[model samples]
Target: MSFHYETPLVDQSELAQARAVMGAGMARILGYFREDGARSIRAIEEAFTQGNAAAMVIPAHTLKGESLQFGARRLGGIAESIEQTARRCVEQRLAPSEVGGEVAMLRGCFNETLALLESAAPPSGTPRPPMPGLAGTRPVTFGTAPRTFGRRTG
Candidate 1:
């Protein structure tokens, strides 16, 4: 069965609201995201490689919170899914193998989110370009291939 991923690249209203509170600090926040986001992604992969399903929760949760803070709702949602799946794997006594599908889904979402952010590059030193209404929507295409840990298979 196919799953329809409907979350957008970012939520403009949420970003605008955050911008109001953060003011000029928004630039630094985006910069932190740019640096730490990739690190968190890599951390998730590393956790998978170690066959530690529980370890996935930390990075995924961290990414989820950070993504939400930066108004990247879709990315945050995907991260949240990863976190929940990891917890479920533990709670239901499922093997790490059982998490393969969710991991693949997260990878696809992460890749999509990264591509959108990269393409929307603002001028150097400028904060991330706030994606407006319906501006970041792209056709969702979930991959079926099973991605193995320790390798960038998606």
Candidate 2:
């Protein structure tokens, strides 16, 4: 495995694999990634603002893993960089200020990655076959609310 550093901004093969694994629900999975990624970016920013090097580790690490899962190599690379640098800073009792530039760049990377990810998602209104092994469940698709089977009672 070459790892995220050597990978492109988005590895199509890895993304295809993710698509294969996520099946009809891939769009929802991507949306969740976007939400989690944004939260992680904010956490990283907050850690930098507080000058808490240790605080950056968890969010950065989380971002790095999630990013890689979706083939967002550049975002993963930057998150890994922040995570590694923060770890060193914590070990050496230094501020995480050195990563200020990267911290600033994280949002932009995330936005770009979001675009790439969105583009990779299944186009709206694609028909979904029924999910296996889950009785009485509906497959969620984009641009519409998930289907409900039982009669509504509110």
lDDT: worst 10-residue window of model 2 = 123-132
After superposition, the stretches of candidate 1 with alpha carbons farther than 4 Å from their true spots are 1-4, 105-154
Cα lDDT of model 2 overall? 0.85
Residues 39-89, candidate 2: write the lDDT tens digits. 999999999999999999999999999999888888988899999999999
lDDT of 1 at 120: 43
Give the Cα error of residue 146 in candidate 1, in Å.
58
Per-residue lDDT, model 2, residue 136, is 88
Error of 2 at 122 (Å): 1.5
Query: What's the true lDDT of residue 97 in model 1?
Result: 64
**lDDT (CA) for every model shown?**
0.70, 0.85
Please give, for residues 1-154, the per-residue lDDT of candidate 1 as tens digits.
2242666777777766766555556665666776777787787877777777788888889889988875778788878877888888778766566556656666666666655544443434555444456456895687887767786754
**Candidate closest to the true structure, highest TM-score:** 2
lDDT of 1 at 93: 63
Candidate 2 off by > 4 Å: 1-7, 124-154
